[model samples]
Target chain A: MCGIAALQLKDPALRPQLGSMMHAMLCEIVDRGPDSAGIAVYDVERFVHAGQSTVTLLDSPSSDEELSAALAAELPSAGAVEVRTLGDTTLVSAAVDTAILTAALRAVAPGARQIGRGTHVANLKGVGNPVDLAETFGLASVSGTQGVSHTRMATESAVTASGSHPFTVDDDLCLVHNGSFSNHATIRRGLRAQGIEFDSENDSEVAARYLAMRLREGDDLTTGLENLRETFDGFYTLVVTTADGLAVLRDPIACKPAIIAETDQWVAVASEYRALVDLPGIETANIFEPEPGEVYTWEF
Target chain B: MGVLNEEVVDLHVSTVRELNSALHKAHDGEHWRVTNPGGAHNVAVGIDSEIDVVIDGHVGYFAAGMHQKGTVTIEGSAGTGLAENMMSGRVHVKGNASQSAGATAHGGLLVIDGTTGARCGISMKGVDIVVGGNVGHMSAFMAQAGRLVICGDAGDSLGDSIYETRIYLKGQARSLGSDCIEKPMREEHLAELAELLAAAGRTESPSEFRRYGSARTLYHFHSENSSAY
Candidate 1:
């Protein structure tokens, strides 16, 4: 069992409270996923800066200053490398190409695994009690236009930073899942045959990779998930967020819980309504669980 | 005996366990109001006393589950397993309900004023369920005995592998499950449907509904139908 929460603010007025709102949601679902936590933020100013690429990775043994100096020497064209650390995740930013930055990141911080890369997103992951990790990361202080957080119970993976959800394998994309996939092993073999490498043994990573592949192939968010429903077999309630949108989907059987609440200002989806009760304007929001095998998306 | 002075308990202030513990020992004819439920779980469950309860907001899983001899009125929506395994009494939700609204309920009347998710009355044994809105897929699956009245539509596989239960549907079903066939509604069925509708405070005419029940083909084991299982 896992808990998933996501919010996409339609009105910029509510963006300032994005972190506080999501933190409240995390607190409500801490009982569901006490093993670990991960979050992906889509704000430009508070987490990741605009007009530059940011690469998120697991914490490195090397200090940010040392990594910055190594990165500066590696790429002369990329100017003024900056670093930010939150809990067990670190963000490295530069004005260079994301691919080159990621390649340079591997040489400088060999121990760090790049989990996410984008100009508008920052993925932070840690292994601990999810609520405590959120506190350690200072989630309540960050501001964002959209974000997704996950608390995990570790059904199919070990309790490690790499095994967490919000598998942001692709740039400007994030995916979090709440149930296990019975046929993930078979699907993983197929994707591996196509030269798509994976970072961990978690089943949710396979889904994230599959979605990224589909999105890269020009399938819109809704069609990509429909393809996932046909190919993968098992129970899942998932939330996928992009630079400009957020999407929620449940497997056809849909036994796993999910509720969605929408207002003029924001649209939020969670594993349960408890995660959304403290949100502003929730009492007046249009709330309902999505139908089985249906994809619900919101664009900011 | 619990104190009679506790007439109202705010869930944000008191715990769901405290309310349930108080309800377990409640005196007959006692009334209580719960405020700010905030989508908590297991509210007002397992009570055997004839007490009245009103929850002011949405609830999480298993609200009024395994219930008996109590009336739970929820003013907002409910999460999964709403009123599951109920033994007796009445549970009402003024808003929509999540999956398995009344699974494996042995007795009682469950009233959902809005749409219900999948498996609305799976494995029911004698409880009566009235849904004012649509019911999702696989509703009444393997139902042994009961009556399910849906004033709105039903999703796919309605009443699959059902037994002895009667379903009165006012709207269309996407598809019927194995061995669940629509049957002609008799005068007695109309009388019972009308009674259930009235009990759930619905004003729909009973004549607009169609009755469905088990074909009993799965009752006797047959090798020819083994694949259908």
Candidate 2:
């Protein structure tokens, strides 16, 4: 029900055009999501820049009025903030310290986590098409060797910014998920009991925070994602981004779709073939779907 | 029918790249009769224009993927994925089709005249499928919407993990998959089947077909009962 796209550029020069490539990939998947849009870009030298703040993961689609009120309460008391409501969701963007912003986001949306931090290298997400979000957010100009994105249709959740893909758990890691989670409530309750607070009710955030928790427990991203292959229920294809590499994982059932295509200079992954069509010099032989329950990684 | 004089476009000699080019050249909403189509894969791929395209012979994999707003008729048997991911339009097959017919299609209608292989109309979304003969195993697996009509028998694991789609079968089904069950045919169902039968040009009475769909049993997963299906 959602579209996920990422690029692991081997050359830094490609960063400037990252937004455009992401835009192209997202455009093909416009049908998947048409609610709201956002993007996160990761670069080697600078701190990650995530445009738009109103993005949240919710359990179900809410009303725009409800989101506006929630975001207003989440922001710092003294800071100037503007909340824009899209559907049953609200986005609040501000020029503030990343740490403080993260804290405020968590304070307001207690269960919501700030997934991208100073150390996390992957920038991912989108409300509609990942491609369109990238274009609107100026991601095409980015020149990173690796990245990830998503276009969500809200199969389980409602069509709102909070239900969009790319739920971040900590600063260093973020995840974009396609497919539904059967045991999301169970997992959410388990995590909540262990003191893991959540902002949105989205099942995707539960999985993302789970991986983040595993990372905090000393498991590498690959191992953390692989461990969940059998642990979670329903169909899922997850793309994880880190400073060193881009990782892709699918559920054991492989019920959903995720394709991979590689060229001499770049390796690209998407939910469908059309998303990868615009890649430079892509041929029929270069395209293939990721095996179910398997994880594919591309290093920077 | 007045000699349906039309230029037959053969896909065997054409690549997907070339076929797409020709498909774009045909004016939107215009009728261009086609024929002599061999086993060219991905024919009529990504067609969004509202036009009519007919193929005379057998086809290969993904024959009409991403189709939108038009009519495509094939006189012979079709390969696997006859309408993979089709967005809209109608595809009629005079002969049987291979596996995964209309896989992941979002909308439109797909008609098959002969027996279909495994996984017919898998994960179909809002697409109507009609088959004249038997359908293979796992037919209508994970279907989301639209109607699926079978004039003959169905294989094992029929309608597994189905959503809100409707399924009509005239013959026996080996087994029903997860969350699917047989229901008593109601008056409304009878009327619906009559329309489908008329569209497929079948004279069979509506009473001959049994109705099957999601039983609303397994919407959510339960570890203890998951194995029961």
Candidate 3:
């Protein structure tokens, strides 16, 4: 079993405590998965700079300085690049068009894989204990308005940084999965024929790419996830996040466990209610499990 | 023995093993109280002797699982597989429960005061499940023998490929699975439903409910039923 925790703050007053709250929630589910952990945070002020794009890269082939210099030289329209390295992943923020910068970075560093690029997302992943991964990355100090974290047990692919979750293929989009996909191989081959390149052999990454492809083709978040429910097979409880929306979906059978608690100030989703027991105002929150094949979406 | 001789284990400081060990060592007619469960999994498992256990708080997965003879009550919600594989006994959950609440239980009385997640009584052998609130999809799938009573609505694909298991619902059903159909609630059925309701401590009238069971047409392979297969 794996663990997935996501929180979307509805009240602006709780923004300052987002990181610490998320860390505490993540720690509660540490037993669900101990092999690797990853987190994606979307903070408007801290990660997102006005008129700029933020990109997260995993398994970068070059050092931070060299990568930043290469990115600057490749995109002449790009302004000063700020880089931060956490484990094998790097976050690079630049004031430029996101699509253009992503394409340029792909060409400049083919070996460097882009996890996500958007206005406010900062994705970090590694292979270790979730609590230590959070401590090493200083996650408690990184504040955000919305966040999604995952602790994986390595059921599908190798336990590598690239295989960890919070797999994002588009700007401001991320997904964390708590169950395995039975038809991933078939879907992977179909997507490959469509000229989509995959960075790892992970099934969850395929799910991320599939959703990204759907969103890129103009399907809304709800429609994209509904299509996922129809096309995918096996038990899954997924939490998908975009720039301003959070969506929770379960498979038709809903074999995996998931609980959602929503209060006036925030909506928190986790593998179990224990992860959310300590959240502020949790005693008064409306807690329930999402029904199978039904999508619950909330927007900021 | 005096009343103070009863066993009381607080899960806040004591582990699940200690509670289970205490229950295993207790004799018949003994009573036990487990406090501060706090949603920890696998509490009071594999009890074979007739006894009484009351959990003060929410419990995690497989609470009172594989129990033989005992009356276990949880004052709060339960996680997945709450009374799975229980041979005989009674388990009561005061709040909602997760998926597979009584999966493959051979014999027992499992009651839930709140709704339950998907597959509430899947593959039930001979247990009786009563849910005060609604149940999720694919409940009682392939159930061999048992009875499932729901006071609220049931989700999609209720009782697919079911066996002799009888289902009583007081509210609407989203859909019925293949080889399963609505059956008439005769006088005997009404009496049985009343008995089950009383056993679960529910006050709903049995007349408002309908019964469902297997069609028994798919017990053997037939060329006309190939599409359903």
Best of the candidates, DockQ: 1
Off by over 4 Å in 3: A44-50, A75-77, B1-7, B222-229
Q: What C-alpha lDDT values do all the predictions have?
A: 0.91, 0.70, 0.89
lDDT digits (tens) for residues B1-229 of candidate 2:
3135444455445555776777777777566644545445677777778878777655656887888878888766676688888887788898767678988888888889888877888999988899999887788999999899999999888999999889999999888898898988999999988988887788889999989999886687778985877
Instruction: Provide the lDDT at A6 for model 1.
Output: 92
lDDT per residue for candidate 1 within A91-130, as digits (tens), equals 8999987788888998888788888888899888998888
Residue-wise C-alpha lDDT for candidate 3, range A1-300, written one tens digit per residue: 999999999998998888999998999899999999989998746656767888888777788898889888887777788777878678888888788878877887787888878887888888899999999778787667899999999887898888888998888899999999989999999999999988888889889999999999999999999999989998899999998999999987777889998999999999987788679987678879998889999999
Interface RMSD of 2: 7.7
lDDT of 1 by residue, B90-192 (tens): 9999999999999999999999999999999999999999999999999999999999999999999999999999999999999999999999999999999
- On TM-score, the stronger of 1 and 2 is 1
In lDDT terms, how accurate is model 1? 0.91
As for candidate 3, its clashing pairs are none
Of candidate 3 chain B, the 10-residue stretch with the lowest lDDT total is: B1-10
True-vs-predicted CA distance for residue A290, candidate 1, Å: 1.1
Candidate closer to the true structure by DockQ (higher is better), 1 or 2: 1
The digit string of per-residue lDDT tens for model 2 on A56-137 reads 3332133445644555566545245444332223334444554655566565665433334543353333345444455544
What DockQ does each listed candidate score? 0.87, 0.04, 0.50
Return model 3's CA RMSD, one decimal: 2.7
The docking category that best describes candidate 3 is medium
